[model samples]
Target chain A: MSQQLAVGIDIGGTNTKFGIVDRRGNILCDGRMLTNKHEDVNCFLDELHQHMSVLIEQVGGSENIKGIGVGAPNGNFYNGNIEYAPNLRWKGVVPLASLLEKKFSLPTVLTNDANAAALGELIYGAARGMKDFIVITLGTGVGSGIVANGQLIYGHDGFAGELGHIIVIPGGRLHPGTGAHGSLEAYASATGVTNTAIEFLSTRPEVPSLMREHSKEEINSKLIYEAAMKGDPLAMEVYEYTGQILGAALANFVMFSSPEAIVLFGGLTQAGDVIMKPVREHMEKNLLPIFRNKVKLLFSELKESDAAILGASALAWEMKD
Target chain B: MSQQLAVGIDIGGTNTKFGIVDRRGNILCDGRMLTNKHEDVNCFLDELHQHMSVLIEQVGGSENIKGIGVGAPNGNFYNGNIEYAPNLRWKGVVPLASLLEKKFSLPTVLTNDANAAALGELIYGAARGMKDFIVITLGTGVGSGIVANGQLIYGHDGFAGELGHIIVIPGGRLHPGTGAHGSLEAYASATGVTNTAIEFLSTRPEVPSLMREHSKEEINSKLIYEAAMKGDPLAMEVYEYTGQILGAALANFVMFSSPEAIVLFGGLTQAGDVIMKPVREHMEKNLLPIFRNKVKLLFSELKESDAAILGASALAWEMKD
Candidate 1:
């Protein structure tokens, strides 16, 4: 008999990614389709099934496949639904997992993208063999997935580990999404880095920044990282400020759960030491004495392009019969 | 055959309370001794064993007791040691569980006081049968114990769930105990309530109130609660302020772990609606939409005096061998 494989699917606003994966976390076959083109959830799933069915054939047919796992915005493991995920074309609650299972005729499981990312790290990346740790993704917005006692904490509502929405600054920066002040996401995300740079530039008109040459449309976290690498002081400060806020928030997270480590993933972490040094410094500075130096801060070893699909696939491997 | 019983011990700065409790959570006998006078942990353990031995005899004999469970400041469940606990008279690392086992000739388990309290609630109090919940103790200082996926999270270091140390207000109030500024403990504990009242009074000297009749030393949380009950605006404001801070912090907690309920325990909770109303309101106000109404804020049902002892005994009952 052929070795068992699983189908990993990631539902994004623009595109949907699906891959056939082996038990060892290898993506055997990969495929993608434009999500926005499919206005209906059923159309999207039908297209995904067609794409995945071909991938399974390439990897020696459905008999070799085990199950399907999905990761999307606002995915709920408890009900296997994606409820009010603003990014998705699906409106209200969509029974995504059941739809996928009905199409593919396989066991299926679902969870939020951040939880999938954490499981990805736990099964095949930085958190391997770790029983207690947190994976924080600093992307368009901050997202987190907590793993304790070798299990993902779905909480009472399958929406646990929303660390980004937590008010780290308490009435400082106002989050546009949640409308809460001083949230970690408001200051530490890609948009946050951009907001910080714009805010800093607005306050001091005389500061010579490479950012001034570009229109606001041209500015982003990637461009900011390039500017900081070129020794732009303002660009450097953006990363520093972001890291300080992130580090302080990380300290709070450490104190709350006392994880063995915290693994950072996403675009902001690309700044490396610019974001990490201050984060490490402030996290340690803020921790209670006993918790000091005990938590290992790490960067994700998983490749950014493949991480989401791999993470989603981890959920498939995790599904019990 | 005799009924199996467990010995529960709560070690505090002022006193050490011990009790022999049955499997059904009933106290067969109870006793306590002055902890500060002993000066040494060995002397303390010797006295505790001698005292507990008598309680064991009254319940039948040592053979009838299943095990011993000790809850102390800084207790490490993994190594059974109390490391550098500020409140305890014993200095440095004290192997507390081993000491009790050596003298008492019974298998023993150890955990921090807050964790024990959570276990007590899980077994015999408000958290009964709930899998995911958080217990926040607002005493002289704030502490917390987190239960997720039906087990107390003894993170990699056996010191998970220290919610009090989580920085709620960045660079805000300073915690004298942890030296971390803007920690939850610095703003929501009994000490914090007194300090807020003092700070409020210092800011508004013209406001005529009953608090003005007492010296700075006489104004405490209990008095503040009484004044709030009588509808003193300034005193009422203190509970509102404390609850606001606590509620905002609770919102963040609900986001992080998404616990089914947050059980507030200890002296500060005595203020009842004066605190609960604001805590619930602010918590909901700060929380994201999905978590807002889903998480319940509850007052612990455990009798304050017996909570510590009951919490410790629950740990013994949880032991596997």
Candidate 2:
């Protein structure tokens, strides 16, 4: 009868973050470990369990925990499995939810990280009262979660809401990961921003830029943001170009479901007005007249690192007793 | 009491089709009138009333008719109004449902034509038992209805599922109606097919075939289909181009909602394999690995003329008694 808490786990390509969260969205305790270091999925689960156990004990042991929720790349909600995730070391389908269920003797739920983020927004973040909205995470790769009528769109196969991969520029830029051409992720994400900076520096060599000070390998979204902050024209144009594409893609999404707002999350949003102005301008320029000026484009209210774990945690609260 | 019937009306740019339909999808009687002949909406309603009255009486009067359902361009389901529809002569927001209810002394519902087609597909067409699917109307203009989790996605403003407007080839072609560039409608509709044929014929005059006989004005989707049927390589390439763009757009749609199937309806589908082969090939090619080959691309089973009325009629079945 003690206050129940939920264990939230986020299994990213490089890091696995775990947290003990109360119903009020507070992370009581948390920790992380390198995800790729464990070659065997079983070893990964064992390491995750060892890390989570200490947090569970701090919150007064397993009795206080309601269940576990996990968010990962290629995670399937319908079947609690991670299916052929390219980023992870596991080469094939891995029964992650059941493994955690058995290891902790608790109910477990799993969904793609984007879906978890959407749920987090619905329950605790900016989309709290809205019935229709989209959450786009502009991190190393772009990710999306679409919510309509207050429910997450898991699609028929639990793999809906992959806005990152939607082809924006028909034969424009090539996404190395998905082999997709002109995908939103190719130009809107952190990696995309870095690539845009490099492309601009090389293609427009006559245009002097602060970004040229860094080598191609040394340049990233953060460095570009820093340069842009210093009123660097070339670095500012990188965000302008990235935002233009992101805005166009967002316009296409708006026409699809007509969501009330689009919430942006992750690192690339750090560019602020430099990016958002173009995103808003181009998104409006591309939308059908009826949808223009209607959808609110907002940045995430949740903290950077805490959002993934919190979003993953939000899923645990939905687990049935 | 006698078996109940529903009155269905489809208001198109040129033609207005209306029918009295039974619960089992049988049309007892139907009629058509010119939609633009009467500029005033009231006059149009009066003319429609005079035509529909005979059909309603044939089905045993208003008492036996459960309700009236209407499908029109730019129709809003939540407000039961037709708002600024480019195709319709009724210029602004017309309270169509209330007007119909007032005139006929029966309950009435109104939705966009595409959404109505989706309902038609759900209740009486290829998507009868499917919980999630998309219905694309490839007519003079492209329109779409998206169904997810056994419900139509009405979005926040009841204007959801405008897949036709989603920019497939950004900055590629101009949609004269919506003024957006490279929209799916600008490339995949019947109009788009003709435009593609014109572009091809003019650009590749050297490698010619059967289509040169017709003037630019004479070129249409039907003419191109006939030419392609006669081994016209240039004409066949028109469908190939249209389908490729359509297939790519469908791929983006599949990623959005991950529907079980995509049901294509309208004039272009009459070409059968010529259009379908490329659509399927390109759609599968563009899809991410997980979604590839999983979604069934189907043609609408409903008869072209009857489908509009049938789809509109299906909405009446949901009316509150």
Candidate 3:
């Protein structure tokens, strides 16, 4: 086991996951806390500090920790701040990295959750030794991180890779979250799958569907996936539609940066070939001649339970002087 | 003049322009040759060598030349080959850079013309000292070069930034060149401008304009610009629609890479505020709040007659080793 370790923290809307991680991406110690319980940001920081101290002691004190890396909803790598993250309930910008650094007396780095996931892949997952690739998370909302020329692309403002917002179908689906019409998030996210299932039921009322028996309030993505597994035709059609939309968008992304692989992660990938097959077919069909068969579609190799912690710690490791 | 000068060559379908350029971007001597005259690439190269030898002697000799950089239709920077260029008579994968290196005994590098133009902007024109930006050429067809993290995004393949081929409208317009439906190039290119005018005339027969008088052959982007300059309503509407399409696409591009600036080049920019106003309005309207009003929309600063040569030479200078 590597004696050197970094602390990784992933701050979500409801909870925060923290861990002490080795260079090889093992989470030696871990903790979690309710993020929204404390209304004040400083109180949240104090809670975070208290928990970190315990983990630091377990790893033989602060000296064993090289630095801290944080992944949050609106984290800014350049400024080390989280600005106007709607889900965080914090007013304006939060200088989370500075606060952590001041308390721990160690270096700290911050990046958006998707960017952290990308760094995680680069350090210890599928993207090891690869110079160019993209990681897309199809969870509640869609998120992405772009890597090119062996470096994370932190554009002019430290927020370059927002692939979810790219309009895949003009005047098509409307995103309920961001109000951006025709976004990839509107059709490919977990919520998008549930919403698409709902839309299909209403639009095709005359058609028979297993989903129709469950009603809109009861049928979620999990229910839809279960139905599809049971060979429900309407449920299968929903996955196919979602996959086609996602695949078409992925084709556009390939045209933009031409990454070697596009790694899909999160709840939606659980549908497996029900989604991947259509995505592959449409992405290949839409790609230009030069890029037709070159790009590989991959799944996240990192363990789901430990990925966020492992990914964040990788960024911390990079901050070593 | 500096004793060390790089040779820049711009190979087009019609003509081949070559020049000796100093570090300060000044063209010391220049020459041109008809490209299609020779069916064979070697014959074309020999003629080029004959003319270049005269210009090389005018400065100093082969010793004075630092290296040769070429900008061609389908130039591949990795392999230094022009691969399957539809416009060029050269059959599959002509190793032009290697031939130039063998004959001149100098370091030679080649890249796709748009990428060369991006290097030109970075080294000698608008994008100096900038870390992230995009250069878009809106001429016969829409072409782009993306720069992020202070380097051009070449993706996994040598060709990465083919922003023109991105599907914007989904099923809107069919690209004559790539066969992709509803592409930005189909709406923003000069031919697109002409096509849009024809389509508008047919769709809204009641709409009056000077474009209707010129017939299809005579009504070009230039003629449309002149009509818009003279306050023709139909022509103005055509520009508005084109700008709207371009603006929406730019918004999507912004979401993808979050560039500091998107530099517009080529013939369409000459339409000026007539096109720029709607582009700004729609681009801003479509942009997410985080990126709103942040990205500057600028025009290319390199002089048209000398830009291609200068841009190519900039790439040559970068390949000093």
Candidate 4:
């Protein structure tokens, strides 16, 4: 019980997951609650504090807790604010770290969720020993955290590592969230996969697919994955197309900072080889000879939410006095 | 007279430019020679030494010189070797750095030409106070050096920041040098401009322009610039096309590292607003709202070869004994 612990909160669009994580990445206790339900950020904080108090009390109290770390969409490390996140109900800049510090009476740190995941990778996952690597989260939308020389490239602004928004297919597909055309997110996210499946079914109507059984709304990445597992050609082709775009984007990223490995995380990675095969192939095909076959394409070893929680908590440990 | 100096050498595909640079970026003396005339690197070195010795003598000899820095295509900073450069006739790995060290008895450093140009920008040009920026050399081919957190992103391997080779268009245009299709180099380079003009003239034969005055063999970037200046619609459209592609690629690069600015260098940049206007427009159009209208697009202030030489020389000042 003497071991110091840090509180980590990952604020997602649908759910907010919080946990007490030790330095070794062990989660003593964790909980989740509805995020979008609280239209006001203050109400969200009140509910978050109420639930988190119980977890802190279980772990012996605030004295044992080092501090708090948060992972949120559009969270800025330099400013500690959540600035106009598309997924969040909060309209503008919410000084999340300051709000959390006032509530918990402890120091707090904040960064974008993808950056938090990258820090988690650096602390306890696949990139544990590696100095240069990129962690890409392929969930609701494509998110990436680039680690170069063992540091996350926050760019001149805190908004660096937006790999998903990069236009892979110039004027190809429109991203509903960003309103940008041919962004990697337009074709590689779960939403992107769903869109691709619908497009495929509509365009290639003669080519029968198990995906046809479900309505467009019911058709999702899981159904596509299941169809692929059952050897559905259309479903498999969907992944091939997605992977091709992703692989090409990855090649561009590799050339940018020449990382040691690219760790893919989130729901999309579950497709596994159905997706990984084309990603590896297209990435290698696009790369120059010097860069070819050098970067390791990998999947996240940690559980999705746990990785985010641990990653956020890792940020707390580095908080300065 | 007592000011310390460094020898800066820029090895281009056609010419090798060397100079004696003082600590404050002044080139006291400089000389150029044909790069591929000597098949043997040793003979090249001998000629280089013979020419450089006169400059060194003029500048008061080795006593005032700190070291030497060489910038060449495919020059590796980690291994201090030129590893299989496509442009250079010296095939395979050429240990030019060690050979220079042996020849001059001075500590030597080596990095790719673009990286050298980046360093030059950081030390003496527009990016003097900037910690994050990118330097793009739009010469025979598109070359780039990315600076992040006030340091060049050398990556895990020494060979990072090869932005020119990153594919902007999939299977769009074939790069004769790398056999890769639709590389940024395929459309944004000086050679790429020549190719685009040739392509435009061939495809749009119905269109009339000053470019028709020159034969296919005579048409080059200089001629295209000259024609575009005179309000030739076809030639102006060529620059517009080039900038559109370059701007789109810049947008992708911006998302990757989120640099403060992108400094354009080399011959093609002399087209000025004729090329820059389109690049700025397309880069903005392709970027996410968070990234749009933020990055400063500027021209390199340093003279082309001088910037590379100064940048390479700057590396010498940092070489540890």
Q: Judged by TM-score, which candidate is best?
A: 2
What is candidate 2's CA lDDT for residue B210?
81
Candidate 4 residue lDDT tens string, B159-189: 8888999999988899887889999999998
Candidate 1 overall lDDT versus native: 0.85
In model 4 chain A, which range of ten residues has the least summed lDDT? Answer: A170-179
- DockQ-wise, the better of 1 and 2 is 2
- Overall local distance difference test of candidate 3: 0.84
Give per-residue CA lDDT, model 2, range B1-321, as digits (tens). 663899889887668899999988999999999989998999999999999888888877888988989988888999899977766677768999999999999899999889998998888899999988999998877788999888899899998988888888877798887778888888887788889999999999886778788788999888998998887999888888888999998999998899999999988999999999999999998888888889999999999878989999988988887
Best by DockQ: 4
Question: Superposing all C-alpha atoms, what RMSD in Å does each candidate have to the true structure?
Answer: 2.4, 1.7, 2.7, 1.9
- lDDT score, residue B52, model 4? 91
- Give the DockQ (2 decimals) of all models: 0.78, 0.80, 0.73, 0.80
What TM-score does candidate 1 get on C-alpha atoms? 0.94
Ranking by TM-score: 2, 4, 1, 3
Q: Tell me the deviation in Å of residue A243 in model 4.
A: 1.3
lDDT of each: 0.85, 0.87, 0.84, 0.90
lDDT of 3 by residue, B165-265 (tens): 78888777987666788888889988899999988878978888988887777888888889999999889999999999999999988987889999888
How much lDDT does candidate 2 score?
Answer: 0.87
What's the TM-score of chain B for every model shown? 0.93, 0.96, 0.90, 0.97
Task: Give the Cα error of residue B181 in candidate 4, in Å.
Answer: 0.9
Segments of candidate 2 deviating more than 4 angstroms: none
